[model samples]
Target: MSQKVREIRLDQIEANPNQPRKLFDETKIADLAASIKANGLMQPITVRPLPRKVGEQGRYMIVAGERRFRAHKHMGAETIRCLAVEMTEDEMAVKAIIENLQRADVTAMEEARAFQSMLDRGYTVAALMKELGLKSRNRVLDRVNLLRLNPEFQTLVEGGNLPPAYACEIATLPAALQVKVIRQVSTGQLKTAEQVRHAVIALREALAQDDIFAAMPAATEKEVAVVNRMEAKVEQIAALAALGFKDNECTIAKKVDPNKVKGMADKLALIRNHLLQMEHALRAAAAQGEILAA
Candidate 1:
């Protein structure tokens, strides 16, 4: 396989049909094209020979330069600098994927899909793991797991609204529960990933009990519902407080007596304490059930 750098016409070069990467941002591509127009192509693309067929002249197939090709097209450049090479289909696919991964802004889903593609193309998980500088098999495995996430959740991740840590948390949940958690997050019921994680763990623990329905206290449901509502209200108040409203000022500004605010604060604290006690009692009941079952 000879390697020679040459200036090839942009119209003549074609993107590899087997490129593992699926999505590309037009804005980023246009930006890159503008940059390339201002500064000549610093790096050349890699390509392989395309076998000719009857009644048609073949064109060069890109192996590792899809971004540059698209950018140059956006720039309206007639020709592009490329490095011609010869490689088998499998090698070309890997090179195409690795080239995209080298970009700074590649999405996690893209990376996951690319890795999965390589795996499907006969690469071992261990081999790809080493190639990607992954520390453990589980790290590689986790990327693949992202593919299992619902498209709505995946879109959230790709859009940068949801963090990967949160996505991982959602990944452990059943699809139906994943939708529930996402809805809560979207509706501001769950403020942080930590809150979601705690809720998930608590729910799992509750469900694991043999007679979970009976093991739980009769008042537990009502208590928990009240606590959730109160917590939401507290969060709203805290947000208001963060905007420079003191408890006393808010109360007085609303024409309520300052003493009333103090009294309410004391009452809320007491309610919070009672909620904690209710939680503890529920836990104790569950533990007793576990002991009896054992």
Candidate 2:
């Protein structure tokens, strides 16, 4: 790599195609330019020679220091100090990504994309961890997983409006329902990452519930709380049933009246009869051979 601190013409330099940074704040740029104008560009930008095309000759592409370049452009300077270096395209991409990532404002989505781009080019996770100076594989994987977020939520995460961890937790939900989870988060209905995860689990359970229950209209907060308590009881009963425990084992279970148990049995028998009737109805419909065998 040839590295030289050379003064290059601003007009001859072009923006890097593989730069990980997509959005730049004009206000921040103006501030940086003011700083540079007063301090005289404390650090230099990095650039590489570009192959001449048509009327252009001795042109360069920025490998790093895009912010400074923009600042200089804001100042209308004719030339800027550049650390000229010779690097391959891949090397240039890595340098640009690394440079951008070193900044505090680099978005999670940008980091994820930069990591993914290197990974797609045959780089291993371990290699990425080392190059990116990450302490663990989980850190790298977590950033990369941000790509799984829905576009709307991804934008939120990338813009720093939504926490990346919240988005990551919500991304585990079904693709169709991720946005709803994000909405819940954005509205402060879901507070923590754990809450978002639990909400997702509950949403999935609701989606997996029997059609008769799932099709019901939305309930009030108190109604939802009641249903949640009932669901918990149903789960406990299901576990007990699986264990072949016919009688009550706990104090709460023992508090139930015997007549209540008998009434529940009668209701269960009625439900069984209803199921049989449904099967019979389906069998009647099977005459045309449209319905398959159970």
Candidate 3:
């Protein structure tokens, strides 16, 4: 691509329509404007020639350094320095992704949407890793997964109140459970990514177990140690219950109907699995506490 440096009028320049970055901090822009006013622009923004935009005078579109362009406009400058490059639309899109991603100016959600945009354009995860200079496949996928989170959690990620690591774990839950985790975080109940990971796993397992209980609830109880929103307890009230043996043999108690045996066995297996999960969750929470104490 051909490239050269020159001065361009602000009115003749339009922001790139395909810019990957969506959220820009006004305070930072104002700070940039102040810096430019004091020391002149330390670096020129890059732009390419484009047709005029509707209802706006435009001869060029920004390929990079939009913040600098905004800073110049903020300072009421008539002309700003520019690095003009020639590239096709596809090349321009890739260039924008690389430029913004290389810097730390964007939020996690912005990076996610940008990665998604490129993926939608037919790029594979491996191709994206190579193109973006990212090392880990999970790293790229983790950012993209942030898109699955609700807008409220997304805003927390964007604002830096919640790190993307913890948010990714929370994103694996259903909407209501996601809100539950968020509430826990806000209340300082979950303070680490490890804790959040364990918590989400428990919530997911609890969800599956809830479905089973709802389908085959022998009895319900009002209170439990775990705060599940569903009917929290099931007690066997059958006249002749199926019993589990430690010798790996399935046995139905005397007089138990053959049709009811499978259901009883399933509930027994589910309860056993749930206990194992609860044990693991407890261990994980304890580990998190130890980590914090250390």
Candidate 4:
């Protein structure tokens, strides 16, 4: 393929109608355009010859770099420097997808859609894995799973309303439950990812057998101790309030100030996060039935 960077008028370059990627965030495009204006195009976009009829004006279709192309248009740039290359339609599509995916910020859903498009176009998963430098089939499988998610969930993800990790958890639920969770999240009934995760676990357990909460392990000594300390702090604060101290004074009267309370909260959060990590590790180990020597 011939490679030469040429400055072409923004109006002359056209988006390929056959491009596999359908969704583009206008806000993200605009942001990219602003960045381009400040720090010029760091990477050149790839394009191919536009199939035109005889006696028609020659045009070039973007094989990749649609984001850059759109950004240039939004920035009202009269011209863009692009790498014009000669390639077949299939080659252009594949190259374009690979180029866009090089961006670290590309969403999992977008990657999945791109992979699915390539698969539909006769590219095998193995081929895609090689092309994309992906090591595991499960990595590709995870992205493809996003497509199976409820459309509303997909919309939330594409709109950046739902984080990919949370979205992945939502995708694991049944379609009916997925809708229920999405509604709860959108309505602010579920305010955090942790809450959503717990809800999902409860729902799954409930479905497996009634009264699942009854089987939940009793609070460990550490957890109980943490709860007791928190309750004691609250009681002390309340007693100070009862002593006629103003709210602000009561806050200051505690042996541990608000900052200490915040520090304890942070410590608790770290413990909780560590426990979650351990739980995941144990589950993975159990799945593989691999025993640790130690």
Q: Against the true structure, whose TM-score is highest?
A: 3
Reference-based lDDT, each prediction: 0.76, 0.79, 0.81, 0.76
Model 2 residue pairs with clashes: none
Relative to the true structure, candidate 2 has a C-alpha RMSD (angstroms) of 12.2
- What does each candidate score in C-alpha RMSD? 13.3, 12.2, 10.6, 15.8
Off-target runs (Cα >4 Å) in candidate 4 are: 18-42, 172-174, 183-294
Instruction: Write down the TM-score for model 2.
Output: 0.68
Tens-place lDDT per residue, model 1, 1-294, is 678888888767888776756678899899999889888788999988778888875479999878889998887888888898878887787788788788787777777778888898788998997776666787667767877789888888888787777677777766766776677677787788797786556445544653576776676778989989988987886686566556545443466577697886788699779878977987866754542232
Clash pairs of candidate 4? none
- In each prediction, how many residue pairs overlap at the backbone (N, C-alpha, C within less than 3 A)? 0, 0, 0, 0
Q: Model 3: per-residue lDDT, tens digit, 1-294?
A: 899899999988889877988778889999999989999888889888876558965488998899999888888899999998888886778889988988866778878988888898889999988888889998788888888899988999988999888999988887777887888888898899998897788777666766776898464465433445323343342222334432545444544688897897799799789878977877865654543332
Candidate 2 regions off by >4 Å?
53-55, 203-294
lDDT of 4 at 275: 65
TM-score (C-alpha, index-matched) for candidate 3: 0.69
lDDT of 1 at 46: 95
Q: Where's the lowest-lDDT run of ten residues in candidate 2?
A: 285-294
Q: Write the per-residue lDDT of candidate 4 for residues 181-206, one digit (tens) a residue.
A: 67777788778889778666755654
